[model samples]
Target: MSIERDHRRAAIVALLLTALLSLPLSGSVLAAGQATPATTAPSPTPDPAAEALDRAIAYLIEQQADDGGFVGFEGVSDPGTTTDAILALKAAGIRGVATESLISSAIGYLEDAAGEYASSGPGQAAKVTLAAVAAGKDPTQFAGIDLIALATAPVATPAAGTPAALVGPGVYGDDLYDHALVLLALAAAGEPAPAEAIDALRATQAE
Candidate 1:
């Protein structure tokens, strides 16, 4: 029984790693040679990365509970996991009225739990912020110490003695991944991002 359990754990870990890795590859820009404009401005081809994200999102939708939230592998509709899935679809350019409605419902679920969420935890708030940003919605609905921190902070590279990330910054167990989400959200919103954030992202660009 223990061996079977161990194997199950390993498999779950593998799936998570694959999902996290696959998440970032879903927003590649078209190559210069392939950047021709549409004929009469016709609709563009479906991006391969977007197609991949659609499959992932389809799987997630299939697994959603009757309550309209996904049941995490661990249990419950964890805000963190849902946030990641939301951001992935958004990054893949899945922004439509239907998508927005679905995201709004999920936000309701997270809101119900926000009281217990750490007041000033950057990590937790980041997930919600990213999802809201992706949906092109204002984040005024979510206000807390963490949210305040974001509004007030210099948005600069962390000063000396500062950590690369704070505990609870959305993509748990992976500092770099969380940082990537923050950078992605800022870019999508046309927000003025810090040079260090840009530099850090450049460092992670895949060849």
Candidate 2:
């Protein structure tokens, strides 16, 4: 879909993003030429952006439930919102045993709930698929579910009153957004989108 002549630009941008996101919450700023102290005080990152990221991450961690899932507006663990949190944390480039455990818990939560959330809606499945890929999990084998397959699964027939010609064999969801997200998920998973799905997507374009 990109028309850019220089694909390297994408790599450059990703590098920049990773550099920007690799902010540590705190660091030990010892006095000049001083020996290590028995205990060190917390020194916040000097960069305002990094400081803000620290706070944001703290807040996010606070939102996690005992089940390792993040709560949405409903104040309960939600699969979609947890998926979003996983992606965001991965983008932040935060790494540690605790963070990995948190991610593992979130992944477990998604696994436990994938049956309800990703079972039918391609949009939702795509989101989970993308999250799995981002978190270094297998999108195909995640939670014993093939998220890529779920994302590419065909939609059911349109309502009886709808025109027979309206439904496309490659169609995966209710609308174009779902279709596009599924395509993105497929790309992320290194899987090929169905030819009919690609054609169906192209058919939705307006001149």
Candidate 3:
């Protein structure tokens, strides 16, 4: 009798399992279950890179001041860092209405500060120029000033009729980093860097 009872119980369990398995479980049913139900499916595994990017973007957004510029350790709204952030977002291909508004406000700040930027060194000017160009703004006409021209003004041009590298300090900034950065920005702006600037940068590499 006990053996018969056990066989009956097992058959009932198998029947219930078969009924559940045979139910019309379509993809839509699974998707709907996954979408609203915190239960039917296993939770999706979070991507580490995506999570990190979200955190980084959030941090950057949080650092923005009312002027739409980011602040440095000095707690002062710095155009340099702000430009860095803008270029970063542009490079990452981030998009949205909020992002566009954020970038626009930052550009507005740069525009208001363009006079001071015009008077700054080539390195600083080039940074602003790149940031402006990346956002589809005209560096030549930004704030009624030609940022591209301003950026390249300090670079020495190759002596007329000569393809020789410039002697002495090739760039106006404190080091070659400025030279490289300015050259890159100039290229991005669709402006050719001075011949001397190119030669000077090339000259840095030992032959």
Evaluated at residue 101, the lDDT of candidate 2 is 68
**Per-candidate local distance difference test:** 0.56, 0.79, 0.74
Give the per-residue lDDT digits (tens) of candidate 3, residues 158-187: 334332333444454545666677888888
Error of 3 at 192 (Å): 2.0
The parts of candidate 1 lying over 4 Å away from their true place are 1-58, 88-100, 114-120, 140-174, 200-207
Q: Candidate 3: which stretches are off by over 4 Å?
A: 1-43, 94-98, 155-174
**Local distance difference test, candidate 3:** 0.74
C-alpha TM-scores of all predictions? 0.49, 0.66, 0.68
Q: In angstroms, how far off is 141's CA in candidate 3?
A: 0.3
Candidate 2 residue lDDT tens string, 63-144: 8899988999999999889999988787666532246767878888888998789986888999999989988889999888
Question: Order the candidates by lDDT, highest first — what do you get?
Answer: 2, 3, 1
- Determine the backbone clash count of candidate 1: 4
lDDT of 1 by residue, 1-207 (tens): 999999999999999778666654543534424654555767898788657766776776775555545577787776667776667656544443145555666666666655455233444555666766666655544633244245323333443443443322222223555466555545554565666555655655668
Q: How close is candidate 1 to the true structure, as a TM-score?
A: 0.49
Candidate 3 has which clashing residue pairs, if any?
none
CA shift of 41, model 1, Å: 26
lDDT of 2 at 163: 33
lDDT of 2: 0.79
